[model samples]
Target: MHGTIERLDDSALASARDRAWSIPLDEFDPGDPELFRTDSFWPYFDRLRKEAPVHYCRDSVFGPYWSVTRYNDIMDIETNHAVFSSAASLGGITIRDTPPDFRRESFIAMDQPRHSAQRKTVAPMFTPTHLDQLAINIRKRSAECLDNLPKGEVFDWVDKVSIELTTQMLAVLFDFPWEDRRKLTRWSDIATTLPGPDGLVATEDARQAELMECAAYFKRLWDERINEAPKSDLLSMMAHAEATRDMDPRNFLGNLVLLIVGGNDTTRNTLSGSIYALSRHPDQCRKLLENPGLIDSFVPEVIRWQTPLAHMRRTALEDIEFRGRQIRKGDKVVMWYVSGNRDDEVIDHPYDFIIDRARPRTHLSFGFGIHRCVGIRLAELQLKIIWEEILKRFDNIEVAGEPKRVYSSFVKGYETLPVRIAG
Candidate 1:
């Protein structure tokens, strides 16, 4: 039995390798949105899960890194703060060339005492009550933004609904000038993301130039907001941190850049992604429309389906064995949330789009441990309220064209989703 099983296993492995090689890596460009729309990723990710849960890939532009593809393993490494630290020296979340000070500026890069302190100062702002308050404003803004939807005429949902609504809400959170909120969104996009496939921002020099421009824009926003008295907004809270909390210029700007990026991009993609999923499954859409109450639970389903922030990289402080693999000290490990969401161990029917999928929060979209998304509740709130408002006004919403995703591996999102208001 053992010999027979060994032969069977060898055969299965051979078959998978043969299939994997059929699609060349050159065919998939990490920075191109077109790649996301292809079948290449789902199969590749599935293969990673089956073959190497903890595997290494050297093909990426950012260089070689280990991919952590299991649900339990990803969580173990994520919450195991002692073994896996978020230090800038170990490399920040994204696998990229970050300026020395750049990694030090954000909480995502901090570990231990510093992470706790910075996160605590910012946590109260996203409390249940605070988010509840923000929900009303977000709903109003979403309504107004969606109100302009011309019947039957197709338009890009990413620009009009997803990106626009989130940007506007971030502006409100920071209490920044309404007219320039889009600037914040643009800066956040630039601060993250490698160059696009058409060789745009391909070199570090170009990326650095963009980062400087991003920092300069935020600095102006900070100079203007820093003087204002503390208000209920996030900026006011962050401003007060200087005296009552622990933060400096570098960290402040870093966190500020992070907040705008986090609050803007992930939600934007998921929102656009939700529409894309519904467009594919009109049955699911009708179920949602028929049982509007499903929206409450469906929001999590939307997030799980999208898995916006595809994967985050964690640097091992020291050598540690994980999921049958020896991860060396200072090795870059990627926690592929997209793969984890489909983990058969934790999630049932991993491939199905079950809107009423109970315990949808069990998904790793927000990640696990202390470093989980600080704006998680806020993100869900935005999606829920936006959909709630959308369902209230429009009877039928459909995707009118192919949805374009972003070129960055860090933020897996749609660039354009032409949608129509159903009659």
Candidate 2:
């Protein structure tokens, strides 16, 4: 039965790719308000899934490429990491143009034995067993953040709570001075902001400048810690690993920047979007409020509705036939998780945000295979706790003004969510 299902999926994707795809190659405007209506991208993805799951277009500003959107089709490419790889030294994990400084930097851009080695050093700490130790603290912090929210007043949820809370946790992880944690957050914002969308903004320079400054600051902190022993934070762990077992400083910076995103933006977006989702769906909100036990399921549903990291790009390491479309060895292929998470075949209903939805956690906002997000559990825990606390503290919470979305196709999330909360 499973084998037949798999074959049918493959055949459907192949047929789709052979058909003329609907996505225009001309300059893509992600900012179009029409896009916001389809931001979850259901209609377009459904069309693309039927028309061309791995179809190509010639006019994309980052140059021509195929969009790999269906769940199984994306799974085939992502799971076969050796063929469609992130280790491409040129463009790195993304197909967009790479910064000159990053052409040969970071473990994320490294392949094979080296990638395994660097990934191993930090992977142990992120395991569920280790994360279990930190859950209590995360819950405590989340409660404190929510418990202190200004009652009956409107505030930007993204700025006032989500970003602030996540950055504080990141500071705890990095063992940095919590007071200046916003610097790390700013560097991450800039890092991911670069090669902006279609690689059009020329903001990569500014992003690199901020990253270098942050890296230098980290190096200085490492020196200071060496002069006077520091605590057991992620930075200290990386520093020790670097000194005892060879590790590149640039890789540390790259991963540190990556960690910030893993730890901050996704969680922030989830929290911010959770508030918006709750405000919009009063029934689900009431359900969560009435039966907080469902908060666990609600976390995953929020991710499904507000998928934090919308998409991740990969470059073909070798000529490959993805759903019948020939992806040349140097070709760029994007995995639209934004589309895949909403894939009708993989998900039931695909549109409803049921708080008690059976297994709402099945979606993959986190990448699959070798590069799957290590902090997935932590992010989930943070969201669940925040929801629990909000439900307890505020009887009613709502959007008081227009919500603004972050202007990035890759990390499509909320930038401002105004709300009035009452006890």
Candidate 3:
């Protein structure tokens, strides 16, 4: 039965690869959420990296955009903030544009002086000293969470482990209410989800309504934090910081959504991805199990392998020529970090899931330049500590079934992954 399922999956992928090649270059909509959900977007990116590298799609559901596919090219665009803008007014950092009325200005969505100011408010949280303090709490929670897992039975690793731990961490970071912590997960999902009958919310209006609720809830917290003596929590830091304390309503909500999604999704998805990656590459799993010291390297390799949050979009500031291609002012440019992570020219044997790569951190999973993920160190710490605990407990954790992936092209993540561990 397992072999038949594997063969069927292979056949479907082969067929998808054929379609990817047969389609006209201009018709390629690699950013389509459907492709990511089905896990059939690999061939499209592969073809683009080889044939186009810097291709433009004249029409997509998200409209016309440029895709930068190679690793070096993505770095070039990521670093050139003067030419490429991440402004919320310019459609923000995703291929899908937020309507002008709906636009929210987060630090990642803002460029330069303002961006640096807002981002610095939360910088103290991820410092070495802070992470050392966080590590003790992380390990305790990870052990408890793993200990409670149902052994000798199938369970969704995504829900039981990934979402649970990351949500807990977010709650700690914000000093949020314990019972209401899952609201962070819900808001994070709602922030990135595309509005449809099948998505988290059925319409853009519904999505915005939920987001407004999130804003209201956080506003209450902001009110509390602003009055208190300043502390280490993210809310208090922002409430006390000069740059963020007096932010406008939309900017406050935008930064709230940014921090929630940033602190929740990337680490959560990568946690699930690590299990799936190891399940597929048992040899690497064995290496880690035998010599647990490899956790340092293993954490990063899995991050690179997953490349959670597949791409980041930047709007061209002005008409500029890049790598022989003419980019016009106000163009929406997407740097395909997913494709760049697998670019053979930059990473040796990019397709493999080797845990001990000498340069595991070479990939662009957290992105590059000034707009890189602020909580990156904290993310690595969570993954490392969880695995350290996981290795100490289970001899084998079997992937009982295939993973159900997220529908959004932006958040590369597992919705569910059935797994079993021996009793």
Best by lDDT: 3
**Model 2: per-residue lDDT, tens digit, 258-312?**
7777888888888887777776667777787778899888888988788887677
How many angstroms is residue 85 displaced in model 1 relative to the true structure, after the best TM-score fit? 1.9
lDDT of model 3 at residue 192? 96
Q: Per-prediction count of colliding residue pairs?
A: 1, 0, 0
* TM-score: the better of candidates 1 and 3: 3
Q: Against the hidden reference, what TM-scores do the models get?
A: 0.88, 0.86, 0.98
Where is model 2 more than 4 Å wrong at Cα?
Answer: 1-42, 194-202, 226-231, 242-245
Candidate 2 overall Cα lDDT vs. reference? 0.69
RMSD of each: 7.1, 7.4, 1.7
Q: What TM-score, to 2 decimals, does candidate 3 have?
A: 0.98
What stretches of model 1 exceed 4 Å from their correct place?
1-18, 21-39, 97-102, 196-202, 242-249
TM-score of predicted structure 2? 0.86
lDDT of 1 by residue, 1-423 (tens): 000011124565566456665655433223223334432356566766776677776565666678888899898889888788777656787756466645545777788776777777678878989888888898788888878877777778888888889889888887778888888777777776666546346765676676667667766755565687667777666667743234665666667777878888889889888877776666778888888899888899989988988887788888988877788887888888988999988999888778888798889998888888898888888888988888888766766666556666677777777777754
Ranking of predictions according to TM-score: 3, 1, 2
lDDT of 1 at 104: 46
Candidate 1: residue 127 lDDT (0-100): 91
Model-by-model lDDT, in order?
0.74, 0.69, 0.93
lDDT: the better of candidates 2 and 3 = 3
